[model samples]
Target: MRELREYLAACERDPACRAVLLTSSAGPFCQGLDYTCLLGLSPDKRRRAAEELARELKEFVRAVAGFGKPLVAGVTGACVGLGVALLPLCDLVYVSEKATLQLPYSRLGTVPEGGATHSLTTLLGHMKAGALMMTGRAITGSEALSANLATGLLWSATAYEDLIAQARQVLDNAAQIQALESTKALIRHSLRAKLEMALHSECRLLVHQWCAPEFQQRVRDLYDGGQLLLQKPGFDTQ
Candidate 1:
């Protein structure tokens, strides 16, 4: 999170950098968090760690939201948990045919992170966002496009190797338009304060939830049942 924020800050300062493209290497864009380390922490330490994590997440999301340039995301594969929640922060999202988005927060015994609690409702409406958060459902790329979550759907058998290239081409084409940055500012101005408040509330609630006894019990239950860390099995202390 610190690295990402620093890079974005550098890009924002560099006059040559007109826009930024966010993507991962081949395979799943982001498989989601592995809770082994956090779940393993002692009660007191866990609370402190959760508070730190909440602060980092809030700062990272704020950086993304406040970016002046176009922030485009190319999703080549599965985007899960916090990854799926953060997609709405990107200015444009292009997803490959195989790209899948899932918010498993409810199953993980946590509320939405990355300001999705408010942004998803604003973008996808109450019922759609509620169903997704309540049920841990997965949505396909085409479905996301249709639902207005994705800017476009990319189809390629090569795992969308050229996804970044396509995104760059689109941005380059749009560069000819007048006052792109100013126009983006105008579009985002009204919602900035609301989004900031939403993020603050979401992070506070998450910190409190993470420290609760129920959340700890739920994590243990999921881990014991072989549900947690099934996709990505590794401890992450950072």
Candidate 2:
């Protein structure tokens, strides 16, 4: 995540960088958090990590959402949890036929991160957004396209080059790139402050929820059910 933060920071600061492109090397864009490590930290350490993680998430959202350059993502496979939370931040998204998006926050006994509460509602409307978050449902690439979450879905990865070329064009042409950036800022300036506040709220809520008694019990359940690492005999989860 720190690497991602640095990359986004570079995109914002580098004059030569006019556009940002995100892609995954792994089979899935993201499989979501490996909660096993987080669920294993000592209570004091867990609290510290959760607090820091919340701040990091807020900073990440602010950096990505406010990036002056056009941001494009090429999703090849599965995109779940935090990955699903991220789609709404990009200026454009292209997905492969196999790409799948899911939000499993409730299943993990937490609420949405990545400011999805506001971004999803704004992009997908109340009904659809509620259905996804409340029901913990996932959507396919084609379904994402139909839902306006993706610009397009490619049948093959060979088609991904075209999207990359399009993003490169933004970086290659200075005047056009600046114009696009200025236009984007003008359009989104008013919403920036609101998004910041919403992200701040999400971070704080998540910090508490992650360390709460219920969340501790849920993690224990994972261990008891053999879903996590070596279990400790006694810990005041409450």
Candidate 3:
């Protein structure tokens, strides 16, 4: 979080940097939290960890919301949890044809983060947002495009490279226009304040939810159900 925030700030200050493209070279883009890291902590420590995470998340979203340049995201694989929530915040999103987006907060006994409660509702209306947040359903790239979550789709055959090339092409063209930054500022001006407020609320809720017994049990259940894998270099569970 700190690294990303610093990079964003640096980019904002750099006159040569016009726009930024966010993408992952690895598969699955992002799979949200590694539950294995949290599952072993005692309830008290767990709550502390959650608080730290909440703080980081709030600051990260604030940076993203305040960015002056056009922000584009390219999703090449599964995007879950925080990944899914981030889609609505970006100025333009491009996804691979095989990409999948899911918000499993309800299933995890938690709520949305990254100002998703406000952003998703604003972008996708009450019914659609409710369906996604409440039910934990996975939506395909085509579905996301249809719902206006994605600006366009990339062919899976060359999705990663295509997304990167396309995002650069688009952003480069946009950067050439002198009014792009001002236009973006105008577009985001009204939404920034509410997004910050929503981020605070959502992050606070996440801290509380992560420490709850139900959420803890759900993590255990996920492991038992073969949904999560425990990596090595295990921490002390005491």
Candidate 4:
């Protein structure tokens, strides 16, 4: 994720790159941290590593939100954990019809990282956000669109090409593209105060959750389960 941010930064500064499109590999968008990496560490080490990772992930999301050019995401399979939060930061989110979005942080005995709780509340309102966080529910692509979480849904295999075309169309209209970016900047500037407050609150919650017994147990469970553990709730191993 950190490397992705660096790459995007370079692209944003390049004259040739008009916009950015982010797509996952064949299976899933991203399952987040490797469980094996976490499992190999001692409990104390794991907690410390998670803290650092969470901080980096939050920064990455904010960077995406503040990117100068249009940002697009082509999501397929499972969009879980931070993936759910990252979608709203993009200018356009295209999910596969079969894709599922889940926020399983609470179930894992930790608070939502990647600013999921904060973004959800801002985008979907407190009631909807509360429901998703509290229940750790998974929403389908159509459901996400209806809820205004995604811009559109397309066939999994064709999503990449279709989203690129959409991006190209945006770039073709230079005047419109510039105006759109200006509007985004204005709105983001207005929301900066709120985003900062939410970020601080999120960090506090994350630190507290990291110390919880249930969260530690969940991590231990994953370690014991081996690679198959990635199949657990809120992650799309397939």
Q: What clash pairs does model 3 have?
A: none
What TM-score does candidate 1 get on C-alpha atoms? 0.88
- Tens digits of per-residue lDDT for model 4 on 1-238? 6777777789778877667887765667766544344445666886887677668766777777778877878787777777787777777888888888888776677677766666778888898888888898888988888888888888866866776676677778667666877877786774555666677778678766765666667877755665223642232111
Best by TM-score: 3
In lDDT terms, which candidate is top?
3
Clashing pairs in 1: none
**How many pairs of residues collide in each model?**
0, 0, 0, 0
Winner of 2 and 3 under TM-score: 3
What residue runs in model 1 are displaced by over 4 Å at the alpha carbon? Answer: 158-162, 175-178, 220-238
TM-score against truth, every candidate = 0.88, 0.85, 0.89, 0.85
Give lDDT for model 1. Answer: 0.77
lDDT of 3 by residue, 1-238 (tens): 5676788899889888777788776567667666655567998889888888788778878898888877888887778777777887788889887898988888888888889899988999999999999999899999999988899998888887787677677666764544887888888887888898898888888888888888889989987997644432111100
Residue 154 shift from truth in candidate 4, angstroms: 0.8
lDDT of 4: 0.71
| lDDT tens digits by residue: candidate 1, 129-170 | 998899998999888888888888887565355666665676
lDDT of each: 0.77, 0.74, 0.79, 0.71
Q: Rank the candidates by TM-score, best first.
A: 3, 1, 4, 2
Assess the local accuracy of residue 3 in candidate 4 as a C-alpha lDDT between 0 and 100: 72
